[model samples]
Target: MSRSLFDVAQSIASVERSEIRRTTGRIARSRQTCCKIMNGSGSPPLHRQGMDYGESKDVQKVHAAIQREKQEPRVGLEPLSLWLIGIYALAVFFGGAYLGRFSGSFSGDSLDPGTVPTKSHGPGPGGGGQQQTAELSPAERGKKVFMSNCAVCHQASGLGSQSQGYPPLAGSEITNGGSRRAAMVVMKGLQGPVTVKGQKYGSAVMQLWESLGDLKVADVLTYERQEWGNHGGPVTKEQIAAFRKELASHPGSFTEADLEPVPADANLPGGEEGAAPPKPGEQAKPGAPPQGSVPPATPGAQPPKP
Candidate 1:
């Protein structure tokens, strides 16, 4: 019984100690508030109800740090260094040196005049070294020129529209007549009723193509000679030059009757079937011809009394 009474007393003392500590805490809090209001030794009360003021102030500092980090620029690709700059300078120097050594002074001519530039590593067809040139046959080159100039009227297949009055060049004698009369027609132009394959076309006028030049004329003629069903010989630059020289005085377009007589030595590869002979004395070699001067009229030869 005595021991039980002793335990009860110890519990009461523990309760009193807790009450004392609680009361002391309340009194100390009240005194601190009073001291703040009286402008004594205590700090002012915080505006926030339950939050810690010190910790709240520390939040602004943490926010400032975050804002500073946000304002800072982001890291990016590495800046060019001294070594990298030096390497770039060296590369530019070497590139300029190489180009200067090889480039033909950046002029109209290429690096090497003899060597033709081509897609293929081998030599070009015409032996010129400009890369624009392609390794193609004469017919192929001529086909391009023909399509650009003649295909409008002659059609892609060389079969001109009869109804439209565009004479067919597919099997026409003009194309196969060894490039003599044809070259003259191209250089000087043709007009009036022209008969091809027994069909006469008089509606359309064949315009002069002297602007196409000798090379283009030869190429176009060569292509026309070999294309379609025609089996005529290729026209050469020399043949065109010779014809142009021989007929230099004949500025006007030739009529069908004017181109009637084929020379005895006409360079017709497919023969004289429907082929018109060379213009009077303008008998030039097919591939090679004398510069100018056709066979002159027989000197002192009296004309037959009409």
Candidate 2:
């Protein structure tokens, strides 16, 4: 019995050893196949055959999707359309031509619509091509000065603001009368209550314009007197100089009471002798003798025979 048990034990040991060797060989083969797949050098092992078909199909789908995608955009790479390029060229050409034609010497004075550029004059007998600028009339120059300095209070229309106490210059008795009163107001300035065209103005005060000089004061007064349908005569610088001398001792601005002493028909000194002739139907003073007309025969004086 002991001998039979020993033979059975030996047989069992040999079968166990064979099973272990088979298991070791299978594990080694699997490891080698896995390394080969990882290295990208061998076909799939038999155990991984089921997964190969699925992986290859997925890779093919990914490649197809990539091939169908649009390319990335790059700036300044595509050529501009022919029509667009032509339009831009046309715009540039026309714009340049327009600017060249309308821009006159690119000067500031050329921008005024009322001003016409004077053509260059050829060399004269004196042998010089003199470029002369257009000269402004006294009234025109006065208008510019008034617009810059006095337009804020009196306004461009000559119709002053009644609510603000500025007296209107248009058709006013003070402005339409002789140059004496107007010259007085301009030279010394004005304050206090004043009646113009029967309307009273008192709140606003006028500053001294004596510093404007005789020429500017005369010019501005001439413009105000002649403008807005007033029949007052033009004022001269000589008249202004004479008036300035008369008022040399007078202090400060004049009030309405101060102006009352001066007669409405009184003309400024030197105005009749040196000032320009009044416009047609205009008068230096209402009912005054017309310029250049000889006075009627004075009280039995012998008249010249025709």
Best model number under TM-score: 2
lDDT of 2 by residue, 128-224 (tens): 6866555556677678768867888899999989999989999988888888988888888899879998878876898878888677787788789
Overall lDDT per candidate, in order of appearance: 0.70, 0.79
By summed lDDT, which 10 consecutive residues of candidate 2 come out lowest?
Answer: 47-56
Please count the clashing residue pairs in each candidate, in the order shown. Answer: 8, 0
Of candidate 1, the 10-residue stretch with the lowest lDDT total is 268-277
The Cα error of candidate 1 at residue 216, in Å, is: 0.8
Which residue ranges in model 1 land beyond 4 Å of their true spot?
A: 1-134, 263-265, 268-306
TM per candidate comes to: 0.45, 0.52
Q: Put down candidate 1 lDDT per residue, 58-168, tens digits, no spaces.
A: 777656655655344458955679998999999999999999997777885342113224473446676464445434455666887888778999899999988877888
Which regions in candidate 2 have their CA more than 4 angstroms from the true location? 1-117, 123-129, 273-306
lDDT, residue 246, candidate 2: 87
